[model samples]
Target chain A: MSPTPRRISTSTAVLPADGRRQNLSLVLQTLRRLGPTSRAQLAREVGVTKVTMSDLVAELIGEGRVRDVGTAEQAGPGKPATLVDLDRSGLLTLAVDLSVPARLQAAVVDVTGTVLHREERAAAVDAGQGRGLDPAVVVELVRSVLATAQHPVLGIGIGTPGLVAPDGTVRTAPNLGWTDVALRELVAEATGVPVLVTNDSDAATQAELSTSPASQDMVLVQVGRGVGCGVVSGGRLVRGAHHAAGEIGHVTVGTDGGETCSCGRAGCLETWLSVPRLRAALDAGDDPAAADSVAEVGGHRLAVALAPLVAALDLSEVVLAGPAALLEPVVPVVARSLADRLLPSLDTPLTVRLATSPEDIVLRGAAALVLWDRLGVV
Target chain B: MSPTPRRISTSTAVLPADGRRQNLSLVLQTLRRLGPTSRAQLAREVGVTKVTMSDLVAELIGEGRVRDVGTAEQAGPGKPATLVDLDRSGLLTLAVDLSVPARLQAAVVDVTGTVLHREERAAAVDAGQGRGLDPAVVVELVRSVLATAQHPVLGIGIGTPGLVAPDGTVRTAPNLGWTDVALRELVAEATGVPVLVTNDSDAATQAELSTSPASQDMVLVQVGRGVGCGVVSGGRLVRGAHHAAGEIGHVTVGTDGGETCSCGRAGCLETWLSVPRLRAALDAGDDPAAADSVAEVGGHRLAVALAPLVAALDLSEVVLAGPAALLEPVVPVVARSLADRLLPSLDTPLTVRLATSPEDIVLRGAAALVLWDRLGVV
Candidate 1:
């Protein structure tokens, strides 16, 4: 199914001002997708009147967020209408990814999710030191990224590895040594820019959802430093009561309670399925044979952890986000494991694929968060 | 958390007609919960002008779905305004529960989900004979219940155990020996009344959600003749792509691949958690020690199956639907098992409780389905 924007999809009554904003949002989103397009075509696609479309486009142009570029090629129409497109060069977004291992990654991305510039800085926290990324270091990184942006910065979107409240407070990030850090407020106050703080898994899931419009319901498992998952059900992000809905890493999969985890628990899914563990297990074995065996075991374990979720949510697809060498070997194992467990009534096969949004999935996801917040596009 | 209705909550733009219906739905839902209320109070609660509220109430009264009673007692000031309420005596709904074992249970429920009348018949199906409930038998059961209704029949809502499509087609109900059954069409045609067919678990979940608005995200595991679950995520039923989202019965939980299930799966959750198997296990035990031991193990297994789901969806509650003797002993066991597996960030403890709906959850759920479909109340 084509991705349906939440605003117009469900016909509900709205005040005129709210309705106008919704129409403008629809117009902006369509322009992002279709590039330069005639007002008439844009209006038709957004199911709005041409007059309303013109007014919205005019407003955007007046705000210097959109530009009219020449005229469209018409076959035998009355006139060649002028094409309107987003002014990509007019605005920039400072997107920061604090989920990277041992590093804080930042990027200046445009409204189109195109990374305009990028930078990376070594984070201050060390794993054995029992510390996490310092809030000051993260702020410094954001400042560095903002300084490099040539265009006007719209806002800052930070994708962190932690339980993030909707208001952008970091409840806890074990690896980052952070707890109750009002990251959004801190960043916003320091830089005088609007800010959005979200879990890395959720940001990645939003980006994945935006690209794969066909599959509205999916679970994206990030097997990086930890084994967290982001769930998109019924075309919306399933943020739980405490904003930890998709934090699946700590859920125990091993019945034996094998290894103690950072959370003071045994047999956490992360202890077995995280990238570091998988790599270590492979390294402990003899070259190819050991890696293959480790992959199979890890895949089977992942399937065990995900089967209940797939069955419970009736998810149509599962995507793995990690190095291909690690993820590819696990795909078939997970697929076979799920096939054996799922009900026959679920006739439609659950497709397991890798994330398709290039190497900077988390970075792009951070940018997408800003897009969603500003435009209501997602 | 209070249950937030979808409409107007997000402040998104809506078309006039849709906005009107949404407002109307809000008004009706409020009346359903609050009983008779003055229009000014309702207008204030719904955030609409008194003129709009009066217009909406007038339209509903014209449709014979609402009525105005005499004025309320005089307050300290001006005259009391007339009160409006749902026309409970104006229409009735026939709710059928075909999920019961060898029994087709039904009721004549009012708008408030009050069972005015009820009837049950021996469903024409024998598992030993490999025969299932005939569609004709279900239709006849609905007609029999409709005959007893004193008010105008609003429609028929059938809760069946199977994969139901949005249009009410039963893709497959293995226990019912039904495949590709146009159940809604069959019943609708027979009685000349509108019909809705849904998975019994989903219906039960809806009813559970309707009554318990505080906990919007929950899982209701119906351990009756088979093991099935209904998921309520983001305050709405999580109906899967094939309408089998919560069909966890066939999802293999045990690694042993123990007994072969009716779905041709081994070590399925149903093979271990189904009511029949649990009862048989208790029956085979010579004493309470053995029975309690079996219950403890079963509860652990159920917890293992649910831990991943609880983590993945951040579900706050799990409600078990089964005989108290069977479910009560399992609750503490399940809780202990989950406590060992779940992450600490999920600070809000997961509560495992028994179904509070008396004896006929599916029947009430069937009524809820109609209420939700017609008034957008749920």
Candidate 2:
């Protein structure tokens, strides 16, 4: 997660202006993604009128945010039209993934979700716990990464794992031993730049806006040392009143209170499904193939746990996140359970598939969060 | 639930112009809730300026939505100011609760949440199944109740006990043995009014909004013949992506997976906490003080099941649907587990409470749904 910017997304002052400015940015973003395209193509692509497209393009050019690069190859037409696009050097963003355990990971992203420069170093958070992670070291890591950058970093978005209040205070993070920590203030103080803090799960959700096969309504269950889920319901992230809507790891899935969890409770879904537990469970299973694996559990229980949710929601798909070794065990179990419990009258079952976002889903999400923030999508 | 007024709610042609009208309605609702108040009081009460209030009131009076009543004694020594209120005679509303077994509950509400007239009929749903329930009979029962109404009917809102779609379809209701049933269409066809469908639990949530000391963020658990929950996250009803976010009944609280549920699942939270099971447990237990015989045994298992969620969401309050026989036996178990599992770092313990609404919460919620639809709150 890059640090949050100095200014909030969408100035309250600018909000009263006609929404055309927002539409203009959207056009720039779309053109950057589709590459240089003619004005007619942009109008159709952005679902805008030719006049609106030309006006928006003019505004973007006036701001030096877009360019008329060249002409497209003429097909059997009158004459080839010139293609326009977002100026490659328009804006730079800092994508920071605070979920990375060992260090602060930072990357510069352009208008298109393309990485400009990326680096990582030991995090200072460990030092704050007196267990070796230091905030200063983490600041140094980001500073060092910034050293190689040339573009003005418009904003920084950091995706931390825990409950993040909208204002950037980390309300609570068990892993980092942080509670009510004004993290963005400290990050900005350290880096001399704007800072933003968001839940790591939400960052992963923002990552989806850039992935292929855009989801209509999405669920992202991130499996790591601990487990969490990020939800996109009704086309927006589910940020509950307390900003803790995606904390699904602590959902109790066992009535017997089977295993103790770090949350100081037994039978917590996270304790059973976490990487450490799955590995432990695999170690307990005694199968040669499953030995020393996190994915060795019988997927049956997991399927039972999630079935009702799927049935109740009438959701068509879910994206699973985790190393293949960890999630492999539960995939088939989820598949079968989904097939059996669907309304018997329905001919097809819901799809439960692994996230195909490049292996760096969290990293990608962190970057996307920066982009969304810069553009004020929310 | 009164019928949903689709014709008015979906008038895109009235956009921008309606935004002004909508603000006036917002002002009217605020006044209804606060009772008669001066324009100055209205401005402060509705979170608007005096100028905005004046503008809104003028439009509202022009539209006959509000009227000025003579002044009462001023608390302080200012000139007695005229008081304003919703003009009940401006528009009439009808509310219906369709899921109350053997009953068709109806009421009239003005722009305010006040009840004007109340009526009900003995009715049942989906009698075709051995459960002796019939969807058709239930529909007709609602029709008959509306037949005696003196005021113009608003849209109808039906609160069922199971999953509902955004478009008002009853997707799968095991208790009612209904599937892919177009409830909105049926109610519309029968009453000649548009309709909205909500789960009983979600309806309870809406009902909470009208009560004193309203919950900002809480969970409402309806422990009837079946166990279900409505989540108020971000202070809004969490309808998930497909309007089924709170299907905690099938959350698998028991690791044993020994108990079976009507959903054909084993070890669902509903199997143990539902009314029948709670009653059975009380009857079987030797404890003399266990007078609240749940139709079955509902106990610590429910608390344990809720443990993970408490830890996960860090939710501090829970509102249990009340009734001496229904809620008394279940509250303690949930409270103990919630308190015991809370991490020491959290200063407060999660609370278990009762709904302020009546035993016919779902039915009342059904009625409110109609009001919200007609008034365009939903």
Candidate 3:
């Protein structure tokens, strides 16, 4: 009951290599969270000696990753402390979002998580023609974005809709008609920059965590053309043994059959909860009662699917990311269903809500992937 | 995808204090895994300098937790290194399992996970009489066990059937008829030994993990009087926000009406999966078909409840711990159900099996609880 300690593995010791990386990551994350701070203050906050802190800060400055801004005001102090902070705008990351229907979106983001430049292009390949987005087109877009970066570019991060392998291979993405596409290598080869690729839901999860760093255990259900989920447990993404941890779209929710899914399964969560399906129900010409019933049914299916997860993980919240109109009504129903299914606990009441920035969550999450990969800072 | 790195929190830096504890834990674990090891070899295996390893080993020997066990045979070495090993029989742990129906079981366990002495007593309290296991009875058992220890006792660990809080309070144990009982405080005060209390299933999870230490993401479903689960993700026990992460008994499996549960819910997983219900069905004369049907239904219900969890966590295995006769048939049904629900993956195929040591899992897990809490080794 004391927060369960991580199992100590055979190689659990922090060797010198791990120590340096961990310390560097800690310093960067502390600066990102607390803004600017003096070396002594940073050392105290990071639980390191003043000498170690100074050495790490100097290393960061030497690498042009951080800069000493100015001396702090004296408060009956012996020496005016110099404040060190991240060079937020000096480094950039190119992020691409290929999950949007028929559109390719890319952005150049800085270390401060701000988008410096953005562009959109209609995808050349068509899903209707049984062709996925062309790798050449993605490579071309990466080239265009890399050329626009005024500062040093860290890497390219792509959040695509698919079952992405750990090696940045798209195992299969029915929506994009892709199978085993080496997106990372393809883009890296053409653009000559390092690349990181992940499932769109995973990207969105990173985006959500970037905004709410306090959430250690939460699930973000992204309902786009398909319904998928991103799971964060103990402040780390739950990438399952197969890198399919949150592939819940095909999971059959209930016995009562509804529409058939593309996977030839009836009553899949996506069949009822996908944005397209929900929008269709809502756009069914002002039949308020009918639309409400559709939303209610979708909510019930989602709750049935999520109740066990909520119970198993003791999740703090479930964030819905998609069109607000379709998801707003579904939220209360999911909340009610979960309440009825799970044992009532006053101490940790579950929260089910819509995402704050659903529109650009995947895009920003792409940037987050680059930050984590290149800088080891989330 | 490359095994999602653990999020580096602002305070993630390994301080000098953390470094020492982590190194000690690592050395102890390595020795536990590799058996009697020399200081030089241990230093190499633990990624520490020879001097540091010697210091740690000396500290451990001084505490009488480990002993110098002669020397390792030299092969072209400058010196015959002294081998240090855990003093397995020198220290003992008093473990109690209150989860076994109508009985109180306790054991004296050594550091090497051997049960040196075991005892069982018929519980005085009766669930049929609307009285849970009495606190006085448990305290008496602990006192008796304390007197039987042949060596120095490290602590007392209790695996109770209840919703245990982080502070070691039994929030509620319907089976034990306990609520808001400060069991840890009671036992520690009576016997003056440090105490650790956890839910029975959680303790069983620890036991399973002891036998198979490589299982990082797995769920152990202990189906005894009622259904409950212990989830281990990222090599840490998933104690939910309210310490109710694996309370899955009341989760409604399907819409089909079944036997009503004590919670007044129809179609709860417990209604189909509890040992009592399955035994009753299996004992109904030579109706093999009916018994098979019961097992099949229970298995299907379990699959429905677990499908989402498996999908969410990307769990590698689902270990069923219960009566083998009843659970053996449930295994295949669960496998098939999961196969139908989850996306088929060749790389990380899910494994469904029964726990090898089901009868005494809770008792052994109680010992494991002490090992983790007192020694910081698991």
Candidate closest to the true structure, highest DockQ = 3
- Write down the lDDT that model 1 would get: 0.80
RMSD values for the candidates in order, in angstroms, are 3.5, 6.9, 3.1
TM-score of each: 0.93, 0.82, 0.92
**What is the per-residue lDDT of model 3 for residues B267-373, given as tens digits with 9 covering 90 to 100?**
78888898987898899869888888988888988998898889878889899998999999899999998888777764768999999678678888888878878
Worst 10 residues of 3 chain A by lDDT: A1-10
**Candidate 2 per-residue C-alpha lDDT over A226-313 given as tens digits, one digit per residue, 9 for 90 to 100:** 7777766445566654667667666656445567776667755666676666766666766746543334333444554455445433
Give the TM-score of chain A, superposed on the true chain A, for all candidates in the order listed: 0.92, 0.85, 0.94
Local distance difference test, each candidate: 0.80, 0.63, 0.83
Candidate 3 segments exceeding 4 Å error:
A1-12, A39-41, A49-56, A71-83, A124-130, B1-12, B38-44, B48-59, B70-83, B126-130
Query: lDDT tens string, model 2, B1-378?
Result: 011111121101122344454555467557657778788877776556788788778877887777888887777787888888777765555555655566656665444455666676665555355464455775776676667566665556677766787777888776666778887777778778666678888887777755643455567777777777776544556665555666777655554655777667666667777666656666777974554434223656666555544443445567788455656756776676555544432344466877775555665566666655555333
Candidate 1 lDDT over B1-378, as tens digits, reads 012123232423345565566667788778887889999988887777899889989999998889988899988698788999989887578899988756788899887678889888886666557787777777777788888888777778889987887778898787787878988788888998778888999888888887777787889998888888998887778977666788888787745556787777777777677677678878986787877876787788889899989888888999998787888888999988888888654477888888877377888898888877766665
**What is the overall TM-score of model 1 with all chains considered together?**
0.93
Candidate 3: lDDT of A210?
88
